[model samples]
Target: MSSKRERRWWTEEEDQILKAGVESQSKQIGEVNSLMSWNEIAAMLPRRTNKDCRKRWYKVRSDFIKGTWSREEDRKLQQAVQQHGLKWALVSRDVESRNADQCAKRWQHGLRPDLKHTPWQPEEDAKLLQAMDKHGNKWKKIATLDLPNRSSHDIRNRQVLKQLF
Candidate 1:
């Protein structure tokens, strides 16, 4: 027997069912998300299999799951990653929502700020060299010297460029 069901888009009504299923299934704080069984939640949404119900439930729950991305969400994700590095758990916490996976995926694409690509002006290069001399190649500290639109990474890359050339 074949094992594939034709994929179709979910309706708003189905979304409502998924929300209700999540509500009925889960109760209280930090109970490990057993809420309702997959089978039970699937039964609540017509034509949705257990896997579908489970995946959809994630979309419905904002925590440890996600529904949609927003600009504000992208900003939060960027800020969190900046503050916490690739520590996804800590980043997600700072973002105030989303599972670690969602946070990771969003960060990999959205709000991954574009690196400076234009040729550095001579003045900027001089300032960078001066900053390096003052700060002793400490890129993070040099960046704090107010190189507009330049991150510590940019400061580091500028030094690398000098070595290469």
Candidate 2:
């Protein structure tokens, strides 16, 4: 026998409660950490687990920036990459309003100087098809092993483009 919790989106009231709880604790301690803070916070929301509270706090936090990247941000990302060489946490500090994961993705997908942006040739498309057939949907493997100049994002998009036409 097994038990499963109901699945649903976090409500606005729940988000407010989570935000207030996290902010209150952060103010008290200068930073919120340890399982104790989360456990205490979770106690307030009977339905939520400690892990759920922590994850939702990250999503609702004011510093969680999103949306299109600016040219200035791109320039900062380039400089950060040069200075830190893939230490993404350090790189992220130089680019305002972006996280380490965002910084790494921006560099890998768009900023890397060596990334080939030219139109795909017919031969390359043929090669992409063969790689897909051989490897299924493993875009990273296809990008790395078969199309070194392309990112996994590009390889995945190409397959989508193929499907449309």
Clashing pairs in 2: none
Off by over 4 Å in 2: 1-58
Best prediction by lDDT: 2
Could you give candidate 2's per-residue lDDT for residues 30-69 as a string of tens digits? Answer: 7644323888889888789987887677566578578799
For model 1, residues 40-59, the per-residue Cα lDDT tens digits are 87887778898787666656
Per-candidate TM-score against the hidden true structure: 0.37, 0.68
lDDT of 2 at 136: 96
Candidate 1's C-alpha runs over 4 A off are 1-117
User: What TM-score does candidate 2 get on C-alpha atoms?
Assistant: 0.68
